[model samples]
Target: MSHRFRKPVNIMPTPTIDLAGPVAGIDTHTDTHTVAIVTETGKHLATDTFPTTSNGYQQVTEFLSAYSVVAAGIEGTNSYGAGLTRHLIGHGHVVFEVLRPTRALRRRDGKSDPVDALAAARQVLTGQALSIPKDTTGPVESLRMLQITRHQLVATAAKLLTLIKSLLVTAPVTVRQRYATMTTTTLVMTLSRCRPPADVTDPVNGTLTSLKSLATTYNMLRAQCDELDNKITDLVEVINPAMTQIFGCRAVTAAELLVSLGENPQRIRSQAALAHLWGVAPIPASSGRTNRHRLNRGGDRQANAALHRIVLVRMRHDERTRDYVQRRIKEGLSKKEIMRCLKRAIVREIYQVLCLGRPVRQSSGLRSDEFRALRSKKGLSQTQVAKKLGCAPARISDIETGKRRLSELKLTYEEFLKTA
Candidate 1:
């Protein structure tokens, strides 16, 4: 018979979910929320609304207290419903911070507020939603605030530069004459001194005033940002001193991991799980003759960015990482594939770092049973693993203990994520 390709059967038509207990479904909004109490039997016992305020919080607490809420699942936990989540979590609630239902889910069942809420709650309760990453510690919370402010200030500064460029592109030659190429400060000063060219009265001067106001505010924000940066820097030095010792792991990468992972890394159970959270893991997509995998595009973009920075730094300075890339190139893997493998290998490095119980030194002895087991299982000696991961062998110590693991513990919601 001629070879005939046929569509492979999907072993499982759907994802498996074995929810243990009752779950509360909450659809969070800026001003109001829709909450539904769902029983293990999949019945909605109660549905109600609460204002996004303290009194509303009290109302929710009273309502939630009546039922044995195994877990409360809320969408937008990081943004609109953050206050509500904090309130619930503060009251000893296991809050499953779920992503909003996908359009596929909505279309699959048809859309409605109730449907969305139920999907979110059930999704999380079933372990499909997993959870979002958040920090309850004071230092981590402070670091997050600082990062937000710093990022905002930097973005504003970038916008100012963009505006200056756009202005030059559109301005007439008279304005463009010599002042166009001036630096922002120089341009601001020159414009301040020009006096509107008399007859024209400088319509752009009014615009310039607004831009200058933005610049002044930008300066204030920059100062605030600088203070925050200093505080974060100090915090990183104290918390992740070993991470700083790694040649390619700069302060920014260190800060991101510190703020993202906080003092505890056990919150994320495994390095594989952590890789998904960092958006560095690859997912296989294969059926019959077609076989391929793709880099995960879902995760904390911020943490992913930090990982990229580390990789870039290592590529430039770390001989081991550079050589690995070169070898991978010789082996016929594309540059992107080489980087992806390096990133996953970083997870292994993270595992080793957390295992050794020492600072991030190039080589640290691993005499403990745990260390031996880990190394034996991976089939790499301490130094070999350290070199591959671009980290110190001493870091392997922290990886063994609960001191460190991976940053940003949120997993992706890919269709094929079990391998990850």
Candidate 2:
């Protein structure tokens, strides 16, 4: 026997139940959002759909306001739901990130917009989802957009370079022989400067034209990447000069860390949270007589990569790090084990710098008393001094207190005296 299944029908308007101060959940999509409202005690009050636009967002707010919405759970706040989440937050609604429904639950309850929305609301009501969405209205957002653009340009340029090389391999022997021995940089420049014969009927002419075109594009992309690099450097320097001053923390690495942490690094709550966000925190893998921690394979892989780079640089160049590694090696720890420990330590160091806003000290050949005298004589506050010198106030304080070198100040006493 054959069976036919009917599609779910949406014939009912949004139901408004008699309840005060209800909570809402949203299942977000590209063009629309499904909202479910429930009372504080877990009673379903209403379910509605709204378009994903300014007017629709306002209408959803007004609809939720009718029931005195206390809080809301939203799915995909980083993606499809980002706009709605921003809208809801702007209107003072407490928003929680709702996890997607499990496959088991989907099988049992059947899958639909209303069903997922209801599930999200119930998840929030029962305290199942508790993550606060990231604040995307700051410098980090600007950095993220630039990074994404640069990444796309780089990928395109790489593909074009690969294609150019592949074409060179198959071109006429004379053409291939002329280019095969050249270094990549020289080859790109040579191809870009080529004057292809203006004859499409010839294979060599066609190959030369293609190579020249792609090489020109590749050079343009390289120029764009350089421009992006400069912008990223300036922005990172302005956002936190100390960040770039850290060992192995360049503009790209700093930007990745800032993007991973969001604007408010305090949202991390603790060192463990920071470690977990970077995916460097160890996971317990204990069973029976064996007790050990396994490497975490989740969290922001980009942030994890930044941490890895820091570890590798320190291992190769920093004397203290080298000594520590040797000690750990003597204690029977493998290189991987030592690296894990080093990554965790680096995470702690970066967390302090990023979250606490600590400044790095550079050498300025002057005594502590001279530094303090110069600042006081100029009638400048620590903040004013920090601003003039382009360092952190904490670094200024350390300089004056003899905890840090006076050379740490960007301006030496002689320069400041002259400016005064």
Candidate 3:
């Protein structure tokens, strides 16, 4: 000590770590959340359970604050973990949607909240979690709510209509005879207006009362659905007018597509990614000699249904779509195969227009010279072509002159010209 007094030595304090690659994993439930913190090296630091309240979310942030979090993996981000995910996101945290452990993994590890949370953390640490959670704090969320409500209302109305029909089928002769000849709209109107006796003791009165109640409820639900439809249409048009303008694409189908894309469409990455997400992309199932792809049954079924709806409508109404169908059929592609091809092509077009920020050009899959040459060879006049296609002559003229955008109409018109 006497020797050291001659020259004092300064000791440096340990530097505080700003962040050490700590990742948080949360297994969220309705009432509580099981959270685990792990480091980059896959060391589980701590696991804790917190209530799913604002105070609890705050407490969780405080607990994780001890070690600055680099990222978070959250299970059920669209369900139970939604609130926590939003909270974490608002607090400037990078969050990834973590799928639940596979049954095989769960069987091996045994199941518990702490174990699941720890597994999630470790998955994040190991770079297993990849999907970014949907941001629900936007107009897209409002559209989703409206779309879901309308869907439920429509379903309920359909069930009610079915039940009413069933009841009438078994009703007393007089009641059955009265409704038998009425169309669905007339039946609903008549049933809703019926004034059954207060005493439901009689079978006729009981049936009448039931029909009245169900009809009225169905009408109400139908009205609500119409209102929701209007809202959805307005919102979708405001969000992406080009999507609505696509042949056979209605607001409801567009809404489903938007919901699947989430608030950030860029997160979908590529056209192929979008096609895969919507189940339009085929999955490879190839072997040594037989190389093949199978229908993808795993993506967003709702979006897939939307695409199917669009395809069905286009097949029935769009001139170009009909032409494609005929060509594909002639080329030995079955109806199902043709549908798949159309969906894939539509997805590609949508991706180009929406995600790639390309101007929404009419997808005229035709060369003007070839189309004109085919028409000239067939000796079909533009007016005759317009009449055959049930379109304006000006439309045909514009198509020939390249003044108007026509989506795939050339093949159909050309086919008509050849056959004429």
Candidate 1 vs candidate 3: the TM-score winner is 3
Candidate that scores best on TM-score: 3
Candidates ranked by lDDT:
3, 2, 1
Q: What range of 10 consecutive residues in model 3 has the weakest lDDT sum? A: 1-10
Residue 129 lDDT (model 2):
38
Candidate no. 3 TM-score:
0.83
| Pairs in steric clash, model 3 | none
Global local distance difference test of model 2: 0.81
Q: 34, model 3: CA deviation in Å? A: 0.8
**Least accurate 10 contiguous residues by lDDT in model 1:** 408-417
Q: lDDT of each structure? A: 0.65, 0.81, 0.82
Stretch of 10 with least lDDT, candidate 2: 1-10
lDDT by residue (tens digit), candidate 3, 1-420: 001122211111121222367888899999999999988787878889999999999988887777788888899999999899889889887888887988998999999999999889877765643577888988898998898898888888999999999998899999999899999999999999989999999999999999999999999998898889999999998887788878778889999998887777877667777887888776766689966667779889998999999999999988768876997798788898898888988898888766776666655555555677777777888888899998888888877775655655655665676567
Q: What is the lDDT of residue 122 in candidate 1?
A: 70
Candidate 2 local lDDT, 77-150, one digit each (tens): 88999899889989987888878999999999999999999999888777753576777877887888888888
- Tens-digit lDDT track of model 1 for 119-157: 876776566645543645456666677777778878887
Error of 3 at 218 (Å): 1.0
